[model samples]
Target: MIDLKALQNNFEAVSQKLKKKKIDAALLELLKEESLQLKEKRNLLEQLQADQNAKSKLFPIYKKEGKDIAELKSQLDQNKEKITAQQEVVRLLEEKLSEIALGVPNIPDDSVPEGSDEEDNIELKKVLDTPVFDFAPKEHWDLDSNQEWIDFERGVKLTKSRFSVLKNDAARLERALVNFMLDFNRSRGFDEVSVPFIANQDSLKGTGQLPKFEDDLFKIEGENLYLIPTAEVPVTNLFRDEILTADELPIKLTSYTACFRKEAGSAGRDTRGMIRQHQFGKVELVALAKPEESDQVFDDMLSCASDLLTALGLPHRLVMLCGGDLGFGAAKTVDIEVWLPGQNRYREISSVSNTRDFQARRAMIRYKDGKKNRLVHTLNGSSLAIGRTLIAVMENYQKRDGTIAIPEVLKKYMQ
Candidate 1:
């Protein structure tokens, strides 16, 4: 959540920053108004409680002097009622404020470029070179004309559209990709972790996926649990509502999990292949660092992901996401797009983001620094999407005889 205290203390500054993310100015104003009202009501409630305590103390003096105490009792009773009413008012205002605050997106960093959408994103640089195929490249789904590797029809029969079953080489490739990515991330100082595929409402909310993107989630029936859209939700939330010592300033972890999404917002996009599947495998990187060192950690994460692609000999490019294209909880984001020979263009295969203290505040993750407790900066990135990487390998390594060659790095894992 955006800091309400910061918003209240410097409304104009926060307001300007949020504007870049296309936030409604009027919403910020409403938040400020509710905060002020809550403060006023709390003050009134405190005064009433103080008055009640002072008046109740007078009872002893009244009894000692043998004076009538009925009027004093009546005044105290009325004051108690007023206090109760004021408390309720304060509670409601606080609830309203919290509702508004949780729905607001994080303020974009000053370095983020101004843009309306992905079209305006700035490309940092390209890696390697796009492969030149002597034969015209075919999309993943069309490469295997007999559909031996990926079974699409059965997937629809078992579940629904946008779900596919990998078979033979494709299945092995997917597993190998996950293993390779995890081992690669571990070598870069990220400890490997195994997290649950299911997450509860609180976990999702802590990662900024709830109260706004519910439609895009696959919730379990008759329960508050939902299938995780990404490992980031469960991995980053491991430290939720916890405090860490300063010595553990940076916590880096990598995890591989099956991810599910409803694709509610993506109606007509990438409907033909596994590019936008309902279920897929992903290897994720999550980190928590002191605020002062988060930027360097962010750069490290970006390079880690980019270098992973380069190791596979896949051509890709790094793009800086503009304010409007940034994720809901990210202050800044850099996306890695991998080249697909069939599509003749680069598609996003990974995104590394630094949320700064945004998720920490929502998750209540803090670290002690000398004599003070402060929110730790949180970051997450996809080392690579398993399905997409397999697709990239297939298209880039396809031969004239309609056969796919495995990359040298993943060959050992495939065996």
Candidate 2:
């Protein structure tokens, strides 16, 4: 959730920043009106209670004087009814305000470029180089067709479309990628962790996946849990509702998980390959940092991810997401897109984001700062999407005869 107090205090400034994300100014106006109404209702309820208390205190004097005691009692009863009714109104108004707050996305950082979509995203730098193919490069599907590496039809038979089964070296490559990514990030000072694949509603909401993007989540039927869309949800929520010491401000963690998503709105995009899957493996990096340390921490995490790609000898580029492309909980984000030679384009393999207390406020993840407790800035990124990296490896390391050569960095793990 965004800082409601900030929105209330400076609606114009906050709304202006939100406009970069394409939020309507009219919605902000409506939220402002609702907030004010809630405040008014609360004030009225307090006044009613105060008046009732004052009238009750005078009851003893009226009873002692044996004069107008009945009138005083009637007035007290009337005040009680008014107070009760006002309290209900206040409760309803508060709920309305909360709903609005939950729907509102975080304000984009001032430095975020204004744009409407991925096409408008700004490319920062390219890492490595796009591989030059001696022959016509084939997409992952065609390459897999020349071998028995992937079973797309069986995937559809077993579950549905967008789910695949890896065989032989394909499966090995996926596992290798997961292990390599986890170890690579852990070596970079991130504490390795294994988290539950299923998270409760509160955990989902804490990570900004609920009430807005629930359509994209795979909810577990009959349970209050949902299959986590990303490791960020579970990793970041580890500190949910907890306050840590300032010394623990820069907590870094890495985890590998099989992420599940409904991909409800992403129809007809990347439908053929592992690029878009109902379930995919990923190694995620999450960090909790003090406000002062979040920026550097975010860059450090991004660098670590970039280094992982470099180590794998894969070509990729770093792109800063424009405001409209920012995730719901992110104030700023940088997407690491790996070059897919076969596809002749870059596909997002990782997205490092600095939520900057947006998630902390919702999750109640705070740090004790002397007399006050403050929200911790949270950051998360996919070190690499295992399936996409596999795609990159296959596409980039494909032999002319259709056999794939494993990258040198992954050879040790494969052996």
Candidate 3:
């Protein structure tokens, strides 16, 4: 959620910043008007209460003087009725204000590039080098030839399309990647956490995934819980509605979880292979930092993920996401795309984001600074999406004889 007080105080500045995200001006105007109306209604209610109090006091004077009290009683009753009506009005306005405010996306940082989509995103730098192949490289699905590594057909029989079962080496490789990524993150000062794969609506909303993107989630048939789309949701929400001491400002955590998504809007994209799946394994990095040091923490997180890819001998690049490409709650984002020789292109394997108090405000996660409670900046990233990394490994390490070699770093884990 955005800072409503900031919006109310600096409407023009807030409006200008939000415009980069393509927010309609009318929406902000409606929010402002609703906020103003709510304030006025609240003031009116206060006045009504004050009038009732003043009139109620007069009843005692009338009784002491032995004067007529019927008219005084009637006025008090009428005022009480008006107060009830005014209270209802205030309640409705508050609801409307909350609905509009909760739907607003985070304000883009001033450093974010202005663009409309991923194509407009700026590339920072490329890491390692794109592998040179002696022969035509084959896509992951076709490279296995006998379907011994990945069983796409049987997956559909059990579930549906966009589902696949990793078999033999592929299964072991997936598990190895998870363990290696977790260990790598832990070595970098992040505490390891085990979080539930299912999250409640409040948890989702805190991370800017609910109400707006609920369609992309797989909800329980008759419950408030939904299969988590990423470990970020549950891990970040761990501090929800809590306040920590300033000494605990930068709380870094890494988690591994099975993620599920409905992929509702993606009707016909990445339908084959593990690029997009209903269920996938991921090693996630989440951090909560003080406002003054969030930028440094963001850099550390970016390096942590990018370095992981480099260690695996995977060629990748860091690209800054433009305003349009930024996630709902992120003020800024960087996507790490790994080289896939078979696809003959780099595919996104991780995305690091600094939400900068966006999730904190929604979750009420604050840190005590002196006598004040201040929101903490939240950051989340994938050290690497395990399935996508596996695809990259298969395509990059395949020999001419159709055998796949594990990355040198993952070799120990494979044992």
Candidate 4:
């Protein structure tokens, strides 16, 4: 959640920044009104309590003077009733403020481009060159069908639409991609971790995936748990509600997990092949750093993701997300889009983001330095989305005879 004081002190500036992300200004208006109401209610409650205390003191004096204390006691009793009602009002207003705060998106960083959507995103650079096809290239679905590697029809029958079952090389390819990504990140000072695919409500909320984006989640009935949409949720929550020493300022972790998403608003997008799925494997990189070092950490994370693509010899490019395209919790984001020969365009395979204490504030994650403790900055990104990587490899490595060759870097993992 955003700092209330910051919002109040720089209301116009905050509102303008949020407007770049397409957030409604009315939400801020409501928050301002609720904040004022809470203050008023709290002051009223304090006054009532003070009045009761003052009356109690007078009661003793009246009793000693043999005067009737009945009137004072009656007034004190009424004050108590008023205080009780006022307290309840204060509690309700506080709840309203909290709800609004949680719903508010993080303020985009100053450097973030001011655009309205994905189309306005700026491309940073392209690495490697798109593969030259000897013949008319086939889409991933067509290639999978010709090679019998992915069983899309049976996946739908077994589960539902947007779900697929990998067969033979395709299954091994996904596993190989996960191992390669985890190993690659682990070799780069990232501790390999295995987190639960299911996370509790607090964990999701800590990562800023709850309350607002609940529709995109798979909630367990009669319980507060939900299937994790990314390893970011559980892995980033590891330090939630805790304060770390300054020495542990940057905590880096990598995990491979099977993610689940409802694709809530994406009705007909990427409906073919493995581009979009109900369940897919991904290797994620999550880090915690001091606020001042978050930008550097973000750049490093981006390099780590780019390195994975470079290692696989896959052509890709980095694109800076515009304000409107930024994630709910991210202050700034850069996406790695790998080239897909079959699709003949780049597709997002990973997105690295630095939330700049946004998640830390929500998770209550802090670091103690000397006499003070402050929120730590949190960052997360997919080293590579396993299924998308698989698609890239299959399309980029396909032979004229309809056979797919594995990338040289992943050969050992496949073995």
Candidate 5:
């Protein structure tokens, strides 16, 4: 959610920022109208409450002074009704306002580069050089199709499209990647956690996944439970509705999970391989830090993701997502796209984002500093999408005869 106070103070400036993200101007207009109504109704309710309190005190004095109490009682009754009605009005206003607020994307940081689309996103530069292939590369499916390593046809038959079965080394490789990432992050002082794959509605709402974007979730039937779209949901929600000690300023956590996505809004893109699967394997990193520490955490997460690609001997690039290309929950985001020789271009394998306090305020995840508690900033990213990394490796490391040469970093884990 946007900082409504800031938006209220600098409405015009924020309006211009929204355009850089290509968001509809109607959102700000809605916010402006709702904010006015909220302020008015809230003020009226508070005044009524104060009046009722004052009346309770004066009523007894009127009776004790031998004064006729009928008018005072009648006045009290009328005020009671007025307070009740105003309270209800305020309640309705809050509901409407919060719904609108939930749909608004996070405000981009000032230093964020401005652009309208992917083509406009700034390239931070390549990480490692592309491998010099001895022969033309083969797509992952072509290399693993009949080898019992990855079964696509069976995946489509069992579960719908965009799902696959990893067998043999492919299956173990996924596990290896998860362990590798967890250990790597642990070395950097992040705690490892196993989060529930299924989260309750409150968890989803806490992370700003409900009310809007519900269509992109796999919700459980006859219940408010939702299959998590990413470990980001559960991991980031670990501190939801709580206030931590200030000493615990930066809460770092890493988790491995199978992510589910409806991909309801993504149509006709990356349909060929595991690049855009409905279900995929991923290692996630999450951090809850103070507002001042957010940018550093974002940079660190991006660096960790880049290191994973370099360690795997894969070619990839770092892209600073333009305002329009940023995620709904992110103030700033960096996408790491690995070079896929078979596809002859780079495809995104991970996105690191600093949501600042947007998700924290929604989740009520805060830290106590002295006597005051304030919302903690949140950050999350896929260390690397394991399934996509496998695709990149298969395509980049394929022999002319269609066999994959495992990367040296994974050789110890392979056998």
Candidate 6:
């Protein structure tokens, strides 16, 4: 949620920033009107209640003086009825305000590079080196089939498309990779966690995955629960509706979860291979920070993710996501694309995003600052999508005999 008070006070500045997201001025203005009306009504109700209390206080004096009490009793009954009606109205108004608040996105940073879509994404720098293969290289699907690792046909028989079975070294390598990534991040001061795979609607909304993006979520029928689309959702929302001391400002968390997605709108793309899947494993990094610390924290997360890929000897590059291509809840995002030797191109293996206070506002996560309370800034990122990284490793580390060499960094974990 946006700071309604700040939006009201800095309407123009906020509006201009939101314009990058293409939110209309009319809607924002309507929110302001609703907020003002609610505040006014509630304030008036308070005044009336105070006045009624004062009138009632006179009743004891009148009764003690033996004065007529019939008229005063009738007036008191009428005041109570009015107060009850006002209380109901306040409830409705508060719900209305809540609906508006939760859907509002964070204001874009002044320094965010503005443009439309991924094409406008600014490339940062390339890391390590792209591998050059001498043989007729095969993509992950071909390699996996050749190695008898991924059995997509049987996976479909069991759970349908967008699912697969990893056998032999592939399955072992995947497990090793997951453990290696978790240990790698935990050593960097990120507290590791194992979170629930399914969350309620409110939790999804808090992470900006509901309302607008419902089509993308795998919802439990006849229930408010939905499977998490990423570890980021569950990890970042851990502090939902919480208030922490300022000393706990830069809270860092990492988690591994199986992500589920309906992918309703993403049909006919990346249908093959693990580039996109209904269920995929991921290691996520989530942080809570003050405004000034958010960007640096974002950089640190990117470095942590980049280091993992670098240590695996995978060539990669980073790019800044443009306005149109930025995630719905992120102020800015950077994607790390790792080189796949067989594909001869860099594919996104991870993404680090800084949402600032966008998520905190929606979740009501705050920190007390002396006598005042302020919303904390929240950030989350896929340190690495396990499926994609596995794909990259298979394609890049394939020996002439179709055997895959596990990355040196992951060998210890395999034991």
Largest lDDT belongs to which candidate? 1
Per-candidate alpha-carbon RMSD to the true structure = 1.9, 2.5, 2.4, 2.6, 1.9, 2.2
lDDT of each: 0.93, 0.92, 0.93, 0.91, 0.87, 0.85
Error of 6 at 25 (Å): 2.8
- How well does each candidate superpose onto the true structure, as a TM-score? 0.96, 0.94, 0.94, 0.93, 0.95, 0.93
lDDT of 6 by residue, 291-397 (tens): 88888899889999999999888889999877777777888889999998877888888988888887887888888888788888888888799989999898989
Give per-residue lDDT, candidate 1, residue 259. 95
Candidate structures ordered by lDDT, highest first: 1, 3, 2, 4, 5, 6
Worst 10 residues of 5 by lDDT: 138-147
- Candidate 3: give the clashing pairs: none
lDDT for each residue of candidate 1 in 1-34, tens digit (9 for 90 to 100): 9988899999999999998799999999999999
Residue 387 displacement in candidate 2 (angstroms)? 0.5
Candidate 5 Cα errors over 4 Å, as ranges: 57-70
Model 6: colliding residue pairs = 1-362
1-415, model 2: which lDDT tens digit per residue? 8887788899889998999988878888889999988888899899999999888989888889888787788888988999999999999998988888898898899889999999899999999989988999999999988448889889989999999889998999889889899889989999999999999999999989998888899988999899999999999999999999998669999999999999888899889878999999999999999999999999999999999999999999999999888888899999999998888999999999999989999999999999899999999999989999999999989989988899998988898
Clashing pairs in 2: none
lDDT of 3 by residue, 15-86 (tens): 999988999999999998899889899999999999999989998899999999999999999999999999
Greater-lDDT candidate between 5 and 6 = 5
Predictions ranked by TM-score, top down? 1, 5, 3, 2, 4, 6
Error of 2 at 361 (Å): 1.2
Of candidate 2, the 10-residue stretch with the lowest lDDT total is 144-153
Total backbone collisions for each predicted model: 0, 0, 0, 0, 0, 1
How would you encode candidate 5's per-residue C-alpha lDDT over 1-415 as one tens digit per residue?
7888878889899888777777778878888888988998899899988988998898789888989888888998999999889889999889988888888888888867888789989999898888777777777767766757888888999998998888888888888777777888888777899989999988998888887889999989999899999999999888998999989878888899989999988899878867888898889999999988888888888888898889888899999999878888888888999999888899999999999999998999999888999889999988989899888888888888877788887877777
